[model samples]
Target: MNKKKTSLLPKNFLFRLTFINIFIVSIFIALSSWAVYNTACFLVDSMGTMTGTNQTKFNKTLYYYLWIFSLIAMITGSIAHFYLTKRLIHPLKRLIESTKSMKKGNYPEPIEVTSSDEIGQLTSNFNGLAHQLKKNHEQRQKLVMDLSHEVRTPLANLNGYLYALKNGVIEGDPALYESLYQESERLTKMITQLETLKEWDYISEQSFFEKEMAPIGKLLHETVKMFEWQLKEKQIAVEIDAEDADLLVDKEGVLQAISNLTENAIRFYSGEGIISIKGERLANEYYIAITGPSYPITEKEGEKLFERFYRVDPSRSRDTGGSGLGLSITKEIIEQHKGDIGWKTDEAKNTFWFTLPLETACTSR
Candidate 1:
């Protein structure tokens, strides 16, 4: 199936707006002309009857003057509309062209427009989106390259092992056999994780999960318990502060989201790093606050943290067995559960958190 392109030609937002304005002006002009003509005739009829002059002759001159005045008014209004439309059309065209270039996978070039109006707001938005898209595209391409490299290493080792065995270069020693088995298993696990990520992303994209009344604390506990071994192994201390915490969300979807987030925390935390999982029910919403031990999450990195396959430290990330989709998939799942997600970072504090709705949890609160 062929896809239709949204960005191709320069759209005229200003021209469209001017067209409607012109239509309204024309209607007002017509109504005003009718009223003026009627008033002129009324005055001529009243005064002409009193004077000793030809009433029909005076009425003819009055009608002629009204027609001339109407023509002049229409012409002036049209010229004004044209000028306004011109002022609006040029910038709009520039914006449309920018969008088209971006749609074609061109990183948007820097655009500067000084006009302070709705059009300027649009320009700012366009520039921001373009910048993000360009950054994301570059990062995604790099991630794919790195991931392929990672996967290839294990597979190549396994293939060489098999070739050696077949050619009788290496005997069927248990140690060599175990090494081959381990490499193949590592490759298998990587494939499984990638597949699971793809499926989670698909489900999230389709909006398959629907909102429901869910016990957030219980799910958090369950997810945390599942990672108990990893948490204990790392000497990471976890503190849970749950008082009145419930949310309106997709049950399984929310569980999967927090699980992914916690997994990420476990992978990144240092020895003796403290992890806190807290939940609070606000008047209109419920929030799950997951704060892990600090690493370098700068302000800019926070913005792109949820982006697909974005890694802060590629070397450290690979060492920690991060596939880079854990946080990204968690973000998508939270959105699907009819919730919101965000992170905070600073010199002293770096917390990854998300919020769910409390509208349906009114009773629980």
Candidate 2:
């Protein structure tokens, strides 16, 4: 049998105060009872000696007085305990009720606590948490909607082509087959891009593996070789202006980051396409900048280039075979490196540029 998940109400500082107040009132009652009995005995003794009354009579009178005192003390203590408990617990009841309202998916107005005690602090914290949670929830919903729209189009086309082939809706020709295959490839690429974005999202909120001093030249060498085949097909010339610069980084991750940018350069920077890899070091940071030619790019578009799934020219990006997440992922990686990444685009010559930070060593770009 599956166990049902149940949570107990969270205890707070007010609960602790209730227990302490009860204990203190209990001790006060005990002390007050002892004092009442002693005073009654003292008065009874003095009256017996002064009036020369019989011991039995004095004892009876003292007994009656003690009884009356006990009765009054009991009533008074009961009333005080009830009052104290009401004072302490009423605010908490208000808080609990307000919090329950939040469970109904509304950010309730915060309950005001009068005492300058821990409960007041708790109320403030609760309000802050509710605001933050609401913001994050809204953001998550927007992200889901965007991703669904992005992933659905290619996937629908891919499924449609498969359906056509299976039912023989059209003649079994090579062009039809090829078209289906291309659509499938597009769908697969979209999935891969989504996965990459998901991984970075995970990484941003997770404890990273580690960082070490890594040489940029070697990282670039390996990355270039990995994508060398694609660059060759495009006939895009690649140039490196990097020297031996060691940067503090996660080596494999940094390589992946640079590869994403370079891939963009190869794909979009066309017609005398020059991908210049340049680097320079400043105080406490080294900068690696990628200079490449772009098409019909504007300054405003360049500023928003790193936004998720945002493309300067969607048709150009899709035709050149990219999922538009390349720049976004590159931005994430750079941010993880404790740095910033940005680009500038020139409309005349059609050039796009991006830079990365080097935290711990030499400079290579």
Candidate 3:
């Protein structure tokens, strides 16, 4: 048996380009031939007696040359079309392959940018997307690990206590009961905050905010009131210097954002220091900030504070109990409202501030 011979023409896109170029060349040759024939006829008619043997020979030669030129034009057009189309489509082919790799949970190496064109820009954007996906994947895996450890520790303690009680290995007393209750409560709080964090994450992704015309001062006051007991216990005075302004915002979401900032301030406040809560409108934006005692943190550390499960204090003590999801949730909430949230620290104090559009539309960025 003989092997079938492969066609030399490029396949797929290149083949289509080849066909198109040949068709265009054929049309151009046909139109040129028609024009030339009409011009020759005009010249023969003008030369009245010149239409003889020479005219016949000239017509034959003209047709022969036209055929040869048409063949050359078609061949040249096909070759050029194939070469250029192949080069243009090579980047797209790589992009498709990279996307396939990403679909399989593999982050392929960045494709080299070969030109300063739209194609290069597209390649650059794809690389950026891949980097972000890879980063998110690593963060997700880390979050799961952290979540398991957080849940397991408290459950293990509860299991141990229950087992001891059942086997009569330890006596059930007030202190023991209180300890078990605290463990359970901690576990519940962690789980609850985790749920809240996840909820806000979804809300942020969907850009879901129930906007209402709410008084900024009232919202700030309400958030402060929620921490009244804690404030009194710590002797931390909350001074609210807010100007009354009606903002188009999600009432509950803004309250939660303010509450998270206040909570963190109280948790890390210097002894008997004032927690300054300020709200004001500057130009087209509503600014809200909670300033408290400065912790030992750098600018980079402050940036990471908005990330889920990222704790500012390394101790992770029960006294300052947090699942490290509050700030993350707050960030999501503020962002969903097309607002910006950030923290700034001086030597004496750190101010966590967020800004929202003063004249916010129902569905605006």
Candidate 4:
């Protein structure tokens, strides 16, 4: 025989609680009735005029009435208990079904909030989690598709060039070889960036980062100096206004983030334009901003600017030899430090800014 799984008691939380409360109440009533009957018997025994028959009759009448009253109370309590349990368990059951749907990759209708209680709060949290999971899953799908498209172009070009050379359709001229080498180099760079992004994703997901109190101003200055050659090549003037501020962060990660921002500024700034770097303390955080002259970007484009392989201008990204992962990596680094990074633009300038929490106790490295 196929036996269905069964629970000895109600599995719903409210039902179980009600059952326990009723059981305790019943025990109290029974004890009280016993005490009342014993007191009645003692009083009757003290009266000499009362006979055995009278005593027996009195006891029977008292016990019968007590049983009837207890039965009435139990029935009333059970009716009230059932009503209360229904109100509370209905929402919980809906929530359980929603979760099961989510497990099957189906996002069903949201649970309705019927009350302001712990259960209601739990429902709200569950809704938020479901929304987040759906968003992340969509983003993951888009990332995979984008990555595939990005890799295919370079790969196709490399394959075509190599095939042409193999068939003797193209001579072993130095220029032809150089072109082939550049295509291969582009692929290598893309692969390297992909690997770096993967590592960064792992680190961010694991909340893993080395923390040390490091000077923010010095880091910004050093990062700017590292790009001096590019700044000069682009004929871009540099301005720096940094204050002494220390932050607890992964030093290498911070350095890399600053370097990436500076490199981005150098790449996009108009020739002979100025790039400004600023670092200062803002309340409890050290803020760093990099501003450069560039074309304006729409709000929609700016929203996905930090997404891997996303580019404000695809042609500009190619011309500048960008892999389109720098900002994404920098965003992760800043977020790992429990901070924020974003971009803002005006008619004359484009600014990328980030912040890190300031370390109160400064320590020398």
Candidate 5:
């Protein structure tokens, strides 16, 4: 059972506002009438009682006109006050309704901004917030669907293996167990990477990092060292041609970004090849590029290289032990450090590059 929540404000809030404004106007009018009356009486008394009858007639006429003017002002002023109050309160009412819609998980249409006042600004800000929330909601839905798609195959594989073992349709062998374990491990790794991508996506907004001034060249060297065994196994030679420029960045994040790029290079290298890693300072930015052998990718494919779960060759990536989120995580880390990441193809070689601002406060492109 659910109960509807009650609002704190009264239903006749606009009426109350109108009444309060009219009450204030009436107070001012009454004070003015009292002052005028006192002044008229003083003037009449100052006439030294010479024209007593005339003064009496003048006092009556003055009082009568004063009462009539006050009556007229009160009526007209109340009507105008009510109209203006209604105009101001109408937008607030619309905002409240829009808020309720959002609370019910339905995004509302943009509220019209009809003024250059604070209320108009508030409405504009609310529209921007609604747009962002709607975008996030859509992305979340897509993520759930993509996650289910990625999980289903591995789960099916594991279920088939378990069913066969339980039904005694096939004897359990070491190879069978290894295959099942591999499927389970792939599922675990995909989920872990998805969680990592989610965490970094959130952390990017907060700018959370342990930033330090580190040499770009040294970071590249360290990243290459981390993958020495894999590079040697693949017979891939990594050559670093980097400038020893200092960058203000999070060392752990930068290292992770570089490591992802390096691992990607090793994974996609066509046969035994040389992977060139270059870092240079261009203007106020430190640029890093990793060039290695890869299959031809179109401009459209290149554009989506950093999107989560995106793969140019999904089977090839899976066989190479990729979760299809390495580049996405790298992009997140680079952007969080106020940088840009992209890729380009030249002949048979593909180059993945990124740029970091020399100053940590610079905006990302």
Candidate 6:
């Protein structure tokens, strides 16, 4: 069977709108001409002395005038309809062309919003979406470049050390071996964090939380316990103040988030400083905060603290500052639990806090 060929012109919105408008105009012209013709006939018939020949002539003249009027009306209506349709469909055409350009990875200028109609709203939304996509593209490119630079530095160091030792350019001293090992360790840590971040990115928010509800106080205690050795090494005093609150969360995910925050606090705290963990129930949510003494961070830096690969102290070595993905992972975990995480800094302290919804708090009561 042969498929029917479709006319591209008729498929256009302008063509369809103009055709419908012209059809309506034709109907109105026909009805108007009929009414006028009928009125003329009625007036002629009412003239009692009118002869058949005169009547026929008058009727023919009336029909001729009606035909002329109809033709004029049709021509004028068609021209007006075409102009109106073109105005209405011009924006749509621009949108289609812009989308095609975007498909080719070229974002042209924003679609001009000419009206407050649905099409105008759509144009505005498209502009916003294009801007966001361009921003994300730039960020992704930067991330790739940064990742390469980070990995290359450690790898190059390791390679240089190994090559020097193999060629007898440098003795295989214990310090040299330790340095090489540390470089290898840094590379492994960064790679592992990257993989973990990728997996976390793929996880959906709905499935992030497990069905079990864990006590906030207990989780905080356990998380602090895990960092006992680090706390001791740093001589950081610990304090915990928590309310008895249960949160609907993924047990392991929440644990890891708290652990990361604690570890962050431990790493950045001043020598022999105090680390405080606080938890409290606020309405339908439970809030957890970990604070430590440190130099104040600007509000701007705090805003980006949870972003992947963001470092507070840019000069600090990765070995001391970590892969910079720990806080990012923690942010993701808290967000997946329908929570918010942020940091605040004062004159002599920095605090990281997060809130998780108490899903059954009211029901249990």
* Best TM-score among the predictions, by candidate number: 5
Task: Please give the TM-score that candidate 2 achieves against the real structure.
Answer: 0.70
Give the per-residue lDDT digits (tens) of candidate 1, residues 208-318.
Answer: 555677667788888899999987787788888865555667677678788877877777775345788988877777778888866767777677788655665535344
User: For model 1, what is the error of residue 185's alpha carbon versus the real structure, in angstroms, after optimal superposition?
Assistant: 4.7
- For model 2, the superposed segments whose C-alpha errors exceed 4 Å read 1-26, 32-98, 107-136, 167-169, 206-209, 314-317, 347-365
Estimated TM-score for each candidate: 0.53, 0.70, 0.75, 0.76, 0.88, 0.72
Q: Which candidate is the best by lDDT?
A: 5
Alpha-carbon error at 27 in model 4, in Å? 6.1
lDDT of each: 0.72, 0.69, 0.81, 0.79, 0.83, 0.81
lDDT tens digits by residue: candidate 6, 45-141: 8986689898888888999999998999899989987987788777777777777788889877887888989988988999988887887688679
lDDT of 4 by residue, 253-321 (tens): 899999888888877776346788998777677788999888777798898899887776646445464
lDDT of 3: 0.81
Predicted candidate 5 versus true structure: per-residue lDDT over 150-187, tens digit per residue: 77877887898899899999899999999888888888
TM-score of 5: 0.88
Clashes of each: 0, 4, 0, 0, 0, 0
The alpha-carbon lDDT assigned to residue 93 of candidate 5 equals 77
